[model samples]
Target: MFKLTTAAAEQVMRAAKEGGTEGMSLRLAATQKEDGAIDYRMGFDAATEEDIRFQSEGVDIVMSPEDVPLLDETVMDFVEIEPGKPHFIFLNPKDPTYQPPADA
Candidate 1:
């Protein structure tokens, strides 16, 4: 239960268009680093055993269920911090009406 921002959606759509894929999705998943730190990633594909794809407007983002709890009400934002080094920000828990998944 999530929505994409105009900018984020546009960026994703552009990427999908470039790739020329018939379908696209964005998946959000979590993983543990070698140091036991938890991290997340966004991928493009359909939902699978370890990947969940968020597809909309020709954009595809693949992720894992392990990160669903952290992605609730998350908003993707882009920032031009420096010259060409743009950064994407994850604004989590942004919606008061949003609910997070129970498990990680």
Candidate 2:
């Protein structure tokens, strides 16, 4: 399951509304590259049958089914870095681990 915070949802919804497209929904999707790395993309006024629409705080974020796995147990957060630099950050529950040093 994916989680979208109120702030993130609002910002996305506002942007979509300003795009002046009817029935437009924010879409979030990810794809596996040739190197097996997953990448994410966001769009406004874009959607497909394969996309999953997120509804919260009167806002929606559409995502493709293929991108579901990559978004599993993920959470979206809003952050203010410096001035006039608000951004969204995706957090995954499953993070890579680092190996511990061997006993000397």
Candidate 3:
């Protein structure tokens, strides 16, 4: 299953409220690039019958069946990579360039 960090969930919830997408599930999509990198896209959306639905950190999430394998066991996080910019990032072991976070 996929995981969503608390920070990520907070950001998503905030965005949904601000964007008027409340009550909708967050849709996540993953595609493998030719070079073996995994690309991720996400937004608030209405889940279809065939979509895989789950909840993490009180956030409703949806993903297509075909995207499950690539996203399985992935952890999504929102962090400050630079001084003032924080954004979402996917920690997917299936991605070739992915590196596990070191123990704190």
State which candidate has the highest lDDT.
3
Q: Can you rank all candidates by lDDT, best first? A: 3, 2, 1
Stretches of candidate 3 off by over 4 Å are none
Rank candidates by TM-score, best first: 3, 2, 1
Residue pairs of candidate 2 with colliding backbone atoms: 52-63
Native-to-model Cα distance after best TM-score fit, residue 62 in candidate 3, in Å = 0.5
Tell me the deviation in Å of residue 52 in model 3: 0.6
Pick by TM-score: which candidate is best? 3
Tell how far residue 16 is off in model 3, in angstroms: 0.2
lDDT of 2 at 88: 81
Per-residue alpha-carbon lDDT of candidate 2 for residues 2-75, written as tens digits (9 for 90 to 100):
87788887777666668775367767776656765556677765666766777756666678777788777766
Q: Estimate each model's TM-score.
A: 0.60, 0.70, 0.97
- Candidate 1 accuracy as TM-score: 0.60
